[model samples]
Target: MANHDQVLDASGLNCPLPILRAKKALSAMESGKILRIIATDPGSVKDFDSFAKQTGNPLLESGEEGGKFFFLIQKA
Candidate 1:
């Protein structure tokens, strides 16, 4: 796994909150940095995928473990 520049724990946040919080966090990070988002919402799988596509930020990795979703996004 690539080292994350920051981790955004969006656990328990549903729908757009995780994506919103990730956007905010990404804004604060330098270009080319990686942001790790940990969330519980199953919708986040699609949400993050769309967010990455719409924003042109590459979704480096995504998966689920122990009922939680994890996304690694590389800032554009």
Candidate 2:
């Protein structure tokens, strides 16, 4: 929740969309900037985790709140 550099609300979006949108958002950010992603798809938890590892980005924090899955990804 700390002043994210960008916010991507992928709620109600399925599989690849959430990850794809996240990638686009992260691509637009400077290194070390954070992208706050709010997704409804449960697959995003694992998808984003793998994405961070594969892309060399960092998953700072991830959790759920009020039926929404949230991820804080830092561009690296």
Candidate 3:
């Protein structure tokens, strides 16, 4: 189910790229909108958590399916 307003597929990208793309996408979105990010890097889980805290964005959902990681970030 898609519960987010926007989606950013950063799959195959490592560390900073995923976080960087997410930041760019979120920057283009309005406050209160949710950005769904799809990533393959295992470290992205922790990276997203830190990014959310640092950027003031709320991580609404975080989970994995198959081989991909998903993150739902609500812009603050």
lDDT of each: 0.94, 0.93, 0.93
Candidate 3: global Cα-lDDT? 0.93
In model 2, the Cα lDDT at residue 68 comes to: 99
TM-score of each model, in listed order: 0.95, 0.95, 0.95
Candidate 2 lDDT over 1-76, as tens digits, reads: 5668889999999989999999998888999999999999999999999999999999999999998999999999
- For residues 27-62, what per-residue lDDT tens digits would candidate 3 score against the true structure? 999999999999999999999999999989999999
True lDDT of residue 59, candidate 3: 95
Q: How accurate is candidate 2 locally (lDDT)?
A: 0.93
Error of 2 at 21 (Å): 0.5
The superposed Cα distance between candidate 1 and the true structure at residue 18, in angstroms, equals 0.4
Candidate maximizing lDDT: 1
Q: Superposing all C-alpha atoms, what RMSD in Å does each candidate have to the true structure? A: 0.8, 0.9, 1.1
- Which pairs, if any, clash in model 2? none
Pairs with steric clashes in candidate 3? none
